[model samples]
Target chain A: MPNNIATVLSRQDTWRGRSQRLPRRTITTGHNNLDLLLQGGWPISVLTELMPQQSGIGELSLLLPTIKYYADNNQLCVWLDPPYQPYAPRLAAADIALDKLLVVRSKNHAEWLWAAEQSIRSGALLLAWTKQPPPRYADLRKLQLAAADNGNAAFLFSAPSAMSAPSPAALRLELQSLEINQLLLNVRKQRGVAGGAQLQLSLGEANTQRTNLALLPADRHRTYPVRQFNN
Target chain B: MLKRDIWLYLHFPLLPLEALLPQLPTEQAQKPIAIINLQKNIQRVLCCNTQAAAWGIEPDLSISTALALCPELELLSRQIEQEQQLLQQLALVAYSFSPVVILTDSGSLNHSSVPSNHSSGLWLEISGCYKLFKGYDALLRELDYRLRSQSITAVNGIGQNPLAAKLLCGPDFETQLPDQTEIQRRLLNADLSLLEINRKQQQSFKQLGLNTVGDLLALPRSALSRRFNAELMLTIAQLNNEKPFNAPRFQPANSFRDLIQNPQGIFNKESLLFPMKTLLQHLCQYLMARQCHCREIEWHFEPLIGESQKMQIQLSGSQNNWSTLLMLSRLQLERLELPRSIEQIILYADQFIEAPMGVFNLDLFDNQKTAQQSCELIDSLNARLGIDALSQPILNQDYLPEQASTLATPGKHSNTSLNKKLKAPQPLWLLTDPAPVHLRNKKLYWRQPLTIISGPERLCGNWWQAEQQRDYYLACDSNGARYWLFRETSSQRWFVHGLFS
Candidate 1:
């Protein structure tokens, strides 16, 4: 009987490790390089923070492909208080199912949190995004639990000023611009992976490189070495 | 074999008082409340609460007398319009039990403005329904419970026909007329005053020493026929089921339209809830009777002056439940501001569909239930927040990144627009307005100078409208961020359109 109990306990551990089990499903970010870097894609049922150095950076584009994936699968993607008006033509150009993308707006942070939490807990939505002031630890914890319970991927976008504030997200990445055609992704936090991995990605056209380089600020032009990930 | 038809009668003798009782506040409800109306230039009690009746302040007593009898008597003006509406509401409830419901108020058929002393009643044919409910006792108990739940006090009776049911319905008459033999026995023992006759004729009948129905029936039929009118003869024949009586069957309306006059203009939002509740209850009963559900409702509030303002509530799907409907309405009403407090409130609905099948007949996994709950939550949010405030993004067929996608109200998106496929990869995010950037020496910069390592994909269109020509590229800023930039071919001005995630 004691041996049988031990086997049962071992079975529970196996369930968590999922080594012999089928792999859990994930939503891909649609960029091959980014997907390769993150080990398949964004994991399901957890909160991911997208920390942008400033507004109007291509931070939203990083998630649009993943959002479109869910939308095509008949799941909803909700946006809470996007800083800029999400221009429609560009969204359509990204191949997102417009009908599946929901935009929610509220007057204050409390309302924003309430809407986000409800949307996550509903389970009817596959993805939710919120841009607000740095939420309290308890609020983020509540959102994390709700997202987990509903098996949804929640993304909280914070301003660069909030970099010092503590967060309860499972993953946090700092987004910065390398050039008009390049981006740097700094993985500040990840659940299982080691932090401080920086990835440089090349986007857009490759042939028309006639850019006026003299217009850039010489003092701010510094390069960081990109870290290699072993898969 | 078909069973003989049985009709049940429900009579609310004090309907005017009962209709207003459920909405009365707790403290005032404990006091004696009376509905007073003017009769022959004298104010008299049309109906009195049970508390008032305990103090000998019954209907027909002068208002002054009732006030004198019970010093704490709360007198309310009798609203004949409200009384008529209550009668229709009762008919609707009766229709729920049996299809054949007949409003037995003879005076109301003509839309009389005067409040009648005669107890208003409904006739429900229930022979087909008794077995479904197991038995008449169970049926009667269920019916009584439902009526009481609605805060209505009723005297119920069962008979073979409408006249017999009505005769058995009063406080002084028998409640159940079981069979032909028992019905005849009860009818014989019944007082002659229960017959539909004028006061003078009743007095004459008493003078002739005919107090009971049996007394009049004992006389020669030909002699009675010669003495009474043809209507009286027909009444006797109907009592025996010897003549076919034709009364209009009450059918529930396909649409609901009710106008409530607020004599003293209501100012507070909370005060509107009472009238709103009453209207919605009536609407629900109407739906129940018709076996239908409504997805939309319109409220037309006519202020004291100017044209009426209309507010509409649209649900994602049809709903027959009243509490949920009332809750959604309350949320919306809280956010609404009434400009003028003047005149009348009208609630109407025409969008309806057959009610969905029973829960047992739905999907085994309760998919329908979950969908309904989610729909209700969405509806509530839409009500609290404006409907325009909630939207889903849909793809537009424009080549310009700014015009490619549009936000649509959920459930109203066009299928054609949603089915359009994309031809190429586009940036995930586009700024509402593209900001101008500077290009100096083969590099792009917006805040900080950026490097371009990609080719220019040229796009030009909108000749019919605002013409535009641009060369778009993907560039990285100094901090290692990717951006979608464009240069206007006409002016060589650079702008950032989107960011690469």
Candidate 2:
């Protein structure tokens, strides 16, 4: 291969055809089915746009495992303009370190994008959400470049309407509720792979065990076997 | 064998003019300017610029004579305070070269060669610092370059002690010093007027046929001790290195406070950037010399009219880098609105703390470096936006969802632990205030009719306050969007409290 071509191909952001795929670094999504669908897991050091059909529907739950992974390893996690206040107890219960988490609320669209880009460039796991005045294509591209340069994962949450427009995100997934405990993920776009792949994942079971254990009274303790008096 | 100390003295011949030149307008600075001192009701010229000197103006010339010599000469009264401040600033520069720096008091030298109004001088003991700066020549060159960049002109001389160094510092001083024997030879040939003696003593020396230091040294020690006073004898001993010269070392200020005045007034906000950058650079240099970091800096802008406006920039972490500080200050200035034309700008930073070792690292895998970068980002964001824009979620020991968690300053660790046993999963997003849900057709409706996927988890708390008793449920809308809903038992009102996302 020509030296220039080789150098260009060596870049992490460069995508090749499936027949000559390059191995990329990724963080496991903690779900076997989703990981299988993503080949390994969520691609690292790139933008991942998660467009849910509506609010909730287990959208944030899908990222809880990834956030916990980074937070546990002492990496910073920045949340830009989250829709509502992040429930601390829920995050703590999921074993995510609160100290490693930074929540930033920007006053305007420009500041929001600036904060998102800065967070990504700092090599933090960035989770940003777009508001009524959605970010433009150029803004998302800037964020994508920052993530690729810093080698950190950035997940952007936007309305489902964004799925119709093209984006610079390496991975674009449309999330929907398959059932109360299950979520359906449609791969709208992905790098170096064919898109339109769908996967139904059961996310409710992970928290169901915790909820059941929590239903038990706080005073409940393991019973000790009574020793009969020496007859 | 004992090693001899090498001393370097910096003499500022035109310090009074140079000290105030930065504040003058360009057009005015280009004209011939002279600083005058009043002694016994007689005003005499103390220092003059090259333009004034070209017109026959010299130190000790009467003001009237100087004016007659050049009608365009601009006379300024001597500012002792400004001269002292400039000396301190110069000392800071010298301190960077060597840890031992001494500041000479102005008007302290009574020698005929030294002017009565000559500003203070700086003495640096550079014997131990030769290797650090490669060599004495390189050290001198670096010091000269730094001073020139600040638009300051200084003459330097080298000797075995402070007095000898001061005597060697004249218009004929050499940049490269000679060997010890050669230095002694030059000192012997130096005129007696260079010694720290009054005019009467110099006249007495002249009458006694003592023209050069060699002539005086050629006399008997008993005759010299009997003829000269104690001060002159001590000065001679210090000059010969037979006696040690003891002076207090210069200590850098603990805080940084510098002011830049623009006489013409800065009408545009963008015009303040240059002065702001200069001040920040000096501040960073001061912090580096002190081996500390400043967490907050306050900028006071004195307008031509009205009260001065104050802007304080706070950093999430301590910083000592000039470019970082300048960038942060620019971001803040972009948002500030000046009330009137700014006449002066004062930068003050008093809260300094010792910077942690290895605050910057090149290792890609270092966790501390990553944390520091995150801190820098937080600071930038907070500088442009408000400080309250950034926060970290912290859990509180309370049953109510709103009370269970609150936002705190970033990096603040909360001591409240999660209630492990209260396992009903909380939504990831909680509304600041619950929105009431409407009931239509006897079904729960929030934007649309909702279906309850799970039952009530009764939570009752805040008995001391307006008590709250609600039954929480997980519900989904027609579009499969899930929400956290609750119904108040007393009011029978259903509301949407959070989202699972």
What are the fnat scores of the candidates, in the order listed?
A: 0.57, 0.78
Instruction: Give lDDT tens digits, candidate 1, residues B126-155.
Output: 888866888866777778888878778788
DockQ-based CAPRI category assigned to the predicted complex of candidate 1: acceptable
Residue B498 lDDT (model 2): 92
DockQ top scorer? 2
Q: Which ranges of candidate 2 are over 4 A from the true structure?
A: A1-10, A14-19, A205-231, B106-116, B172-174, B217-222, B359-365, B415-422, B439-442, B451-462, B469-471, B474-482, B487-493
TM-scores across all candidates? 0.77, 0.89
Candidate 1, position A111, lDDT: 69
lDDT (C-alpha, whole model) for all candidates: 0.70, 0.81
Q: List the residue pairs that clash in candidate 2.
A: none
